[model samples]
Target: MRLAELQGWIVNILRRGSVLAAGGLMGAALAAPQAAQANLHQRYRHVVRIHERLGGIASPAASGPLAPGIDWIVMDAATGRILSEHNAYNERFPASLTKLMTLDLAFHALSHGRLNANTPLPVSPAAASVQPVKLNLVAGQTVTVMQAMLGMTTLSANDAATALGQYLGGGSIRRVAAEMTARAHALGMERSEFRNPSGLPNPNQVTDAYDMAILARHLLLDYPQYRYLFSVPSFRFEGRTIPNIDGMLKRYNGAIGMKTGYTDLARFNLVTAAVRNGHMLIGVEMHAPSWIVAYNRMTQLLDAGFAAESGAPTTVIATATSPQPRAAMPPPPVRQPAAAPVLVASRSRTAPVHMIVARSVGHVTRDMIPGWTAQVGAYDSYILAKRQALTIRGERKVGIARVGSAVVHRHRIWRAQIAGLDHNDANLVCSAMRRAHQSCFIIPPSNESLAMR
Candidate 1:
C-alpha cells in the first residue's frame, strides 16, 4: 500500500481509538478471507473456553479501558543510552512481540549458513493448528524460509512463525522456546521468557519493555542484512498481497519496521525503530490501551529523543581505533620528498600513525571528486566507523585517502570510507589493504555517498 493510503487508514482507525477494543484493530486489519477470519475466531473462542476451564478470562474480547500494567522505554540505538523509560522492567504477556526473538534466532541461523532464504521448512499439524492472524498453511506443506519470515513480519502469521521455530529448533517448538530464552539472556534481556514462537498466551511466557528494547536493538544491529524483512510494506504469497501490519513503516518518515503485537492478555505492544540525521532510536510500549496510544507514545518518545539529540552536540563522538599489528598494517605511505606533500610518518615501529593533513583536509570533498570510495567497514555506531576510517587512512594512502564517514541512512549505519579516490586508485587501495589482511571494498560514487555530507 502507498504511504498516503496507509496513513489515511491509520488515521481513520485512530479517530475511533476511543471505542475500539484492545484487539479490534488487529482483527480489522488482518486482511484475511472472511471465512478464514470466522474460522480463526471460532478456534480462538474454543481456546478461550479451554482457558476458562483452567481459570482465565472467560471471553476472548477485552474492552478498551486497559488494566494497569504499562511499561515503556526509549533507547538510543547507537550508544545504548536510555533516553526515557517508565515501568520498563515489569513483565507482561508478550503476545506476538515474542516473534522478535524468533526472528533473531532465524537471523542467526541464516548468518551462520545453517539456513537460507530458499530453504523449505515443513508445516506440521501443530503449526497448522495455530490460531487466527496466521498464514493458514496446510500441514505437510512446505514454505520457503523467506516466505515464512515475510508471513511473520507482515501478517504476524502464527503458523508461519511456529513452522520457523520448529525448523530452527530441530522440529521441536518446545526446544526453540528454550533456545530463545537462552539467547535472550545472552543478549541481556534478562526479564524475558519464551514459551511459543507465535506469542500465543502462556502464563509463563512473559517479557518487559526493557527486554523488548534489547531484542529490537539486536534485530537492528546484529542482523542488519536481514533488517529489510521488517520494513517490507507487503509481500505476495499464494496470489494475495498481505500488507504489513506495522503502520509505522508507511506512516512515519525514517521509521524502520520492528513489530506490533496484541492479545487480550497483552493488550497492545509495539517496538519501533526510527532514524533521523544519522541518529537511531528504539521505543517499546507494552500493554498499551490501544494501537493508537501505542503508536502515539512511540512517536512522542522518538521525536523527543531526536529533538534532544539534535539540540545537543551528538554524543556519538569518534573514538580512536586500537592499533593493528605492524604485520597487518598496509605498507606506510611512500616516503615523500621534503618539498613533496608532507607525509606524516609512523610515530614508532609498533604504534599506529595518525597524520592530520591540515592543508589537505578539504582537498577532496565528496561532491568535487567523481570517483569510487574505498570503504573499510560499515559500523553500527558512528564512532566506530569514524575510528576505522581514520585508522585505515593512516595505514594506507592510495591517492588522497581522506578519511570520511558516510551514513547509510537506509540501514542507520556509518560507512568508514576514504572517499575521492578514482576507480584505479580505489582498486589499488583495496588490493593493498587485502594483501595486508585488512578489509576493503570499492564503492562507486552514487547518491548514497551524498549522505556523507
Candidate 2:
C-alpha cells in the first residue's frame, strides 16, 4: 500500500478504537448510577429495620375485662416514642375532646395578637345555639378571649368554642372547621378530621387515640406559653364557677391540664399530659366503656411511661431532631394569579414568568393574595406552580383547571405565575421569587397555550 493509503488506514483503526472505548465508558457510567441508587436503598432499608426493632416492644394487653373497652396510647412527650399502645389508632368519635384543637388555635391567636386575653370576642347566634354544658353565653354578648378560653378548657363549653370560632374566622363556624382540618393535617394528625369548631355531634368528627396524642404533644411542645390554661382547676365566669371535668388533675401529682370528651358514639375520650421526674408523658385513652375506666387507664399508661425510664439502661434513639422552641405562627395567606392559562393567537406572545406571591415570618394564612402583581407561565401542578407566587398564602391558590386529561395528568403540578409585567419587572419579580425559595420559569406563549382553552 502507498504511504498515504497506509496513513489513512491507521487513522481509521485509531478512530474505531476510540469509539469502542467511549462506548464502554458511557455504559459503566450509567451502570454506576444504578448501583449507587441500589446501595442507597439498601442502606435506607437497613436503618428502617433498626428503627422498627428498637421501637418494637410487646404491649401486653391491659389486665382483665376492662381492657376490651379501653383504647390507649402512651408516648414520651419529648421523644415521641410509643412506650405502650392498645388500640391506639382505632377510630372513635372525639366528642368534647375536639376542643383541644380549638384551644390550641385560640392560644396561637392570643400569642400572635390576632386576639388577646382581654380582647372581647362576640358571641354569634350560632355560638349561642351550641348544645351543652355551656356558659349560656347570650347572642350579641361579648366575652374576653381569656374568659372564653377558660370556659372552653375548664368547663368544655361548646358555646365558648363557637364564640372563638366566630370571632377569629369571621362568624363562619364552617370556615373555622375547615381551617382546623388544614391545621390538623399540618400538625401530622392524619387520622383525625373535624366537621365543626365545636365538637358537636357530627358523625364525621372522629380521630384516633394515637392522632390525639400527636396533637397533645404539639400543644405541649409548640405552645408552652399557654400551658397554664390547661391546668386551671376551676374557672369562674359570668358569676358561675365551673370545676374542671378532669378528675385526674386533682388526684395525680404533676398532672397538667388537657381536655376530656364524652358522647353516645364516642363513649369516653381523655387526653392527659403529665410531667414526672422531669419527663413529660402524654397519654390518650379513647372510647372507654366508662369515663372512670378511661381515666384510670390513662393514669396507668402515664405511670408506666414514667416508670420506663427508671432503673433501665436508657437506649437513646438518635432519630429525633432536637426540638426547637415554638416560634410564632406564619402570617395570613394571600391569593395569587392562576397558573398559566391557555394562549390564543390574538393575545400577545410574551413568555410568562413566575412570580412570588408573598413573604412573611411563620405560618401564613391559607387564603392571602401572593403579591400586588404577578406574571404567568405553564405549570406541572398547582402546588409546584404556586411556589412562584410571591405570597406565603399562595399554596391555597393552586387548583386544577382542566385543559385536557393528557395535559392535566401529565403535569398535574401547579406552576407559579404573575399576570402582565414588562421584561424588567418580570425579571425583578422572578429574582425576588427565587430568593424566597420558589421554583419558577419563563415560557413563551405559543399555539400549545391555545389548547388550554
lDDT values for all models? 0.64, 0.57
Give the residue spans of candidate 2 off by over 4 A: 1-68, 312-453
What ranges in model 1 sit over 4 Å off?
1-69, 312-453
lDDT of 1 at 268: 75
User: How far is each candidate from the true structure, as Cα RMSD in Å?
Assistant: 22.1, 27.2
Overall local distance difference test of candidate 2? 0.57
Q: Compared with the true structure, what per-residue lDDT tens digits does model 2 show for residues 211-231?
A: 788788777776676776676
Model 1 lDDT tens row, 1-453 = 479866764564344334233333443343243334334422111111111122321223332213375677777776555666665645577889999999999999999999998999999999988765666688999999988998888667788999999999999989999999998866766558898898986656878777788788767766666766776655567654444657567557888768988775577789898878767888888987665567666777778778766786333221121111112112222121122111112112222212222112222222112235677776787677656666666565433333444445566666667754545767877888899898888766453234243
- Alpha carbon deviation, residue 381, candidate 1 (Å): 57
Give the Å error, residue 124, model 2: 1.6
